[model samples]
Target: MPHFYFHTENGDCIRDDQGEDLPDVEAAREEAVTVLGEILRYRGAAFWETASFSVIVTDADGRTVVSVTARASDAAPEGWTLQETGE
Candidate 1:
């Protein structure tokens, strides 16, 4: 098992000082997606008009494994296409 940090970036930095012990990176990815969905829902649909959101998952050694993001505008990052997927 390994500890992973789920840091959030919306308007400011949310440092994940307390991490969780997960079996591997795949588990972390699932957790991150679940967390990100919660955050987005909490913010409500109105918030998306103003800001893009992301959950950055990092390992114990501080290496980013994956970044799950929700785009807020027509101008999405290059190489990334915006798909309207609702859960």
Candidate 2:
């Protein structure tokens, strides 16, 4: 097993001092996505201010293993109405 650190950056860098032990890089990648989703789920309102967010995963040796990013854009014209998509 290997330890991976999940650092995040929205506007400022947040270092992950406590890392997680997983099987391999693949697992770390999945964890990164989960972490990213959790962040958005909990702090989604304030997230729009940054316009972009990322989860940077690094191994114990300080090597980058995976990186996950999300970007939001709201470029609607004035008085734009939401159309119902017949989903």
Candidate 3:
């Protein structure tokens, strides 16, 4: 068992002082996705675009094993316009 830490970066750092014991890097990557998914559920769709952040997974010795970065891709069809509602 190896200890893994998840560190979040979005103009600032959120360190995971208490790490989890994951079997390998693959498991750590999966855990990071699940963690980010839960965050997106609360923050909503635009959070990924606005924040442009990464979920960094590190080993016990602080060696980065994987990084998950997200950014919005505006793939709207041509001539599509966003409907604005009165505030």
Candidate 4:
């Protein structure tokens, strides 16, 4: 099994364990996106304008395995901003 660290641009962090049969990096990337989407929805910002959102997937050795950047849709509203921050 492999442990993956999901770091969000909004400074949220989560850890997930992928089974030994986990797929390739592309599959991991997709999972990361879906996880982030769930987070956004939970925070009531699913339809908000979001840009520069990113996911960093690290292996057990703490090395980056893959990174994914999320972009807003073409119809994103003007003057929208992501409220992610670090404390």
Leading candidate by lDDT: 2
Residue-pair clashes per prediction, in order, are: 0, 0, 0, 0
What's the true lDDT of residue 36 in model 3? 76
> Candidate 3: what lDDT?
0.82
Which 10 consecutive positions of candidate 1 have the poorest summed lDDT? Answer: 44-53
lDDT of 2 at 5: 100
Instruction: Report the Cα RMSD per candidate.
Output: 5.8, 4.4, 7.7, 11.1
Candidate 1's TM-score reads: 0.77
User: Against the correct fold, how does model 2 do in TM-score?
Assistant: 0.84
CA displacement after TM-score superposition, residue 78 of candidate 4 (Å):
13
Candidate 4, position 13, lDDT: 47
Stretches of candidate 3 exceeding 4 Å from the true structure: 45-49, 73-87
Candidate-wise lDDT, in order? 0.87, 0.93, 0.82, 0.62
Q: Model 3, residue 35: displacement in angstroms?
A: 1.0
lDDT of 1 by residue, 1-87 (tens): 899999998877689999899999999999999988898889857446647778999999999998898767657567987789998
Query: Order the candidates by TM-score, highest first — what do you get?
Result: 2, 1, 3, 4
- Put down candidate 2 lDDT per residue, 1-87, tens digits, no spaces: 899999999999899999999998999999999999999999898689998889999999999889999988878657889989998
